[model samples]
Target: MNMMGSLVALLVALIWKPDFEEWRLGWDIKLFARIFSGIVISGMAFAVIVWCVDANGPVFVSMFRPVRLVVVVIVASLILQEPIYSGSIIGTVILVGGLYLVLWAKKKEMKSMSNPVETNRTDRNVV
Candidate 1:
C-alpha cells in the first residue's frame, strides 16, 4: 500500500512539473521547507506506527488508527474552531464499530490458527 501510494505520488509529480523558477528564492525556500517538513513528519509517523505494530502486534496497534479520527475531529474543533456536527459523531461511531468487528475477526482468526484442532473439527463439520 505504501509503495502504491508512493507510485501514485511520483506519477502526479511527473505529470505536474511545477516551474519553480517563476517563484522568488524566498518563496521557493518556504515551499521547500514545507515539503521537507511534511516528508520528515510522514516518515517518522510511518516508522513509529510500524514499530508499534511490530512490537505490540498489529491488531493492538491498528485499533488506535480509527480512534485517531475522533481525536482529529476534536482537535480541529478546538484548534481550527471548526463546527462539530451530529453526523460526524454518528460516522465516528460507525467507524469505531466497524473497526471493532474487523479486529474481533482478526483475533478469532489468530485463535483458530493457534488451535489447529478446532479448525479441523470445524472443517469436518462443514463437510
Candidate 2:
C-alpha cells in the first residue's frame, strides 16, 4: 500500500511536469550511492517499526517518530553541516519531554496493573 501511494505520487509528478529529466537518474555515482543508502536505511527502519508495532503495539512504536526527528537533526547538524535554529532546539526539547512523560505514564500504568489495590468494603450499598 505504501509503495502504491509512492507510485501514484510519482505518476502524478511525471504527468504534471512531463519532463524526463526531472524523473531521470543520471550516471552520478554520488547520487546513486545516496539513493541506495536511503532506500536500505528506510527499508530496515520500516521493518523494525512493523516488528515493534506487532510486539509492543502502536503507542510504543509511535514514540520512535520524535526519536527519529531528533536523530535526523543531530545527524544533519553534525555530519551534513546543517544549521540548527533556536526553534529546532526548543521543539526537540519539547519532543523529548513528551516522550519521557509518555514513558513514565506507561511505566506507572504497568506497575498499577501488576499490583492492583484491593479495597475492604463495610457496606455494599456505599457509593
Candidate 3:
C-alpha cells in the first residue's frame, strides 16, 4: 500500500506542479467524510472476500465473476437509465455457459474419485 501510494504521489508530483494551497484538502468535511467512509466500507468488503476464500477455498472466488456481470447490467440499466446492448446479452450467455461447464467438470472429477482405485486416505478437510 505504501509503495503504491508513493508511486502514485510521485507520478502526480511529476505531472502536476501545484502550489501548497491547491494541495490542501480544504474544509470540505462532508466530501472528505463520504470518501473516507467509502474507503472503510471497501476495505471491510475486501476483508470479507478474503475470509470467504479462506473458508470456501480459492476456486470459490471465481464463481462470483459472472454474478458481477449481472450486477453491472442491472445497475447500468436501472440506475443510469442506460440501454442494454445485444453484445451484453451475448456475453452473459457465454459467462453462464462457461460457469456451467466448470461446475460439470468439477462434479465429474469428484464422481471419478469415488472409485476404490482412485480413493486415498488423507488429512485434507472439505466443506
Per-candidate clashes, comma-separated: 0, 0, 0
TM-scores for candidates 1 onward, in order: 0.56, 0.68, 0.59
Give the per-residue lDDT digits (tens) of candidate 2, residues 1-127: 7799989988899889998777767789978897887799889988998999898778888886778889999999999999999989999999999999998998898889999899986887978
Global CA lDDT of candidate 2, please? 0.88
lDDT per residue (tens digit) for residues 32-65 in model 3: 8978877998799789889989985666577766
Worst 10 residues of 1 by lDDT: 118-127
- What would the per-residue lDDT of candidate 1 be over residues 54-107, giving only the tens digit for each residue? 886877676777788888998999999999999889989998898889878888
Of candidate 2, the 10-residue stretch with the lowest lDDT total is 18-27
- What's the true lDDT of residue 124 in model 3? 71
Pairs of residues at least 3 apart in sequence or in different chains that clash in candidate 1: none
The pairs that clash in candidate 2 are none
State the C-alpha lDDT per candidate: 0.82, 0.88, 0.80
Quick one: ranking by lDDT, best first?
2, 1, 3
